[model samples]
Target: MIHVLFVCTGNTCRSPMAAALFNHWAEVMGMSSRVRAGSAGMAALGGEAASEHAVKAMARRGINLAHHRARPVEEAIPKADLVLCMGHGQAQLLRERYPRFAERIHPLMPYAWGLRTDVEDPYGGDLETYEAVAEKLEETVQSVLQKLENSRET
Candidate 1:
């Protein structure tokens, strides 16, 4: 199985949301057996639950983030076949820290959509803000799924 890891600052918002969305879509597309996703934070205190807004926003999309527990980046990186970060800075930092996995580490937007942008963090944002982030993540996740599919065909 191909393990995709989503990384963010705190794992309370963006990364977990992205992971849940990716897993949901992967299963929907019948790729769950071939690929799976997990999430972690660059500096997270392990065990914190996903943010309230994140859980609510995901619920809107029929995806659940209520059970997500924060994890440290180091714990997850070694297992990731591909590590997609929320921004360029995170990607750069991760590459520096885990040089052996540098080739597999990339910023999500540019890698998935060719956009030089960061996935906005909605840590303390309102529900609307969380929703917008979720929409962006959904788009990014769709692109990721397509790329995974294409890779499989080759």
Candidate 2:
């Protein structure tokens, strides 16, 4: 299986949501067995539940985040086939910290959607902020899964 890791500042908001969305979409696209997802935070304290707004936003899309916990990037990166970061700074930090895995690290927007912006963090924001981030993540993760499928085909 191909393991993809999504990274952000705190696993509570963006990364976990992205992983949940990716896993859901992958199963829907019949690629769940081949591609799996995980999430971590560059600065997480570990074991913290996802943000309240994040959980509600995910529930709106029929996805669950109540059981999600925050984890540090160090615990997830080594096993990932691809390390997609929510921001360019996070990607660069991982690349520098794990030079051997530098080639596997990239910003999600640029690599998946060909955009140059960071996936916004909605940590302390309202439900609308989390919803917007989820929408963007949904589109990007689907695009990334398609790219992964194409790469495997080739």
Candidate 3:
């Protein structure tokens, strides 16, 4: 199994969004049995649930974030084949903190869609902002699935 870990400032938002979206992508591509995903935070309030807006946003896509609980970044790397971070800063931090895993750490958006940008945090944002973030995540996830699927065909 290839395990992917999504990282963000707090596990309440972006990372969980990426994890949930990745799982959906895995299902759509029939790779659910091989590719698995989870999320963690750089500075986390462990055990806290995902943000309300995040939960609702995922609900719109028929994904569930309700069971998500915050975890710290330190506990993530060892189990992950790839560690995707929400922002460049977070990716940098992971590389600095876990230098041995540097090659496996990358910014989620750029790694997913060749877009060198962060998945902006929407923790305190309104529902519309969460909706927009969800859309962006879905697009990125779809792009990643296409890339991986195409690669497998070759």
Compare the candidates by lDDT and give the number of the best one.
1
On residues 18-71, what C-alpha lDDT tens digit does candidate 3 reach at each position? 889989989988988877889999999889999999999999999988999999
lDDT, candidate 2, 28-80, per-residue tens: 99999999999999999899999999899889989988999899999999999
Residue 68, candidate 2: C-alpha displacement in angstroms = 0.7
TM-score of each: 0.99, 0.98, 0.95
Best-to-worst order by lDDT is: 1, 2, 3
Number of the top candidate by TM-score?
1
lDDT values for all models: 0.95, 0.94, 0.89
Q: What local lDDT score does residue 153 receive in model 3, on the 0 to 100 scale?
A: 78
lDDT of 1 by residue, 50-84 (tens): 99999999999998788899999999999999999
Worst 10 contiguous positions by lDDT, candidate 1:
59-68
Clashes per candidate, residues 3 or more apart or on different chains: 0, 0, 0
- What is the lDDT, from 0 to 100, of the residue 23 in candidate 2? 98
* Residue 95 lDDT in candidate 3: 95
The local lDDT score (0 to 100) that residue 123 gets in candidate 3 is 81
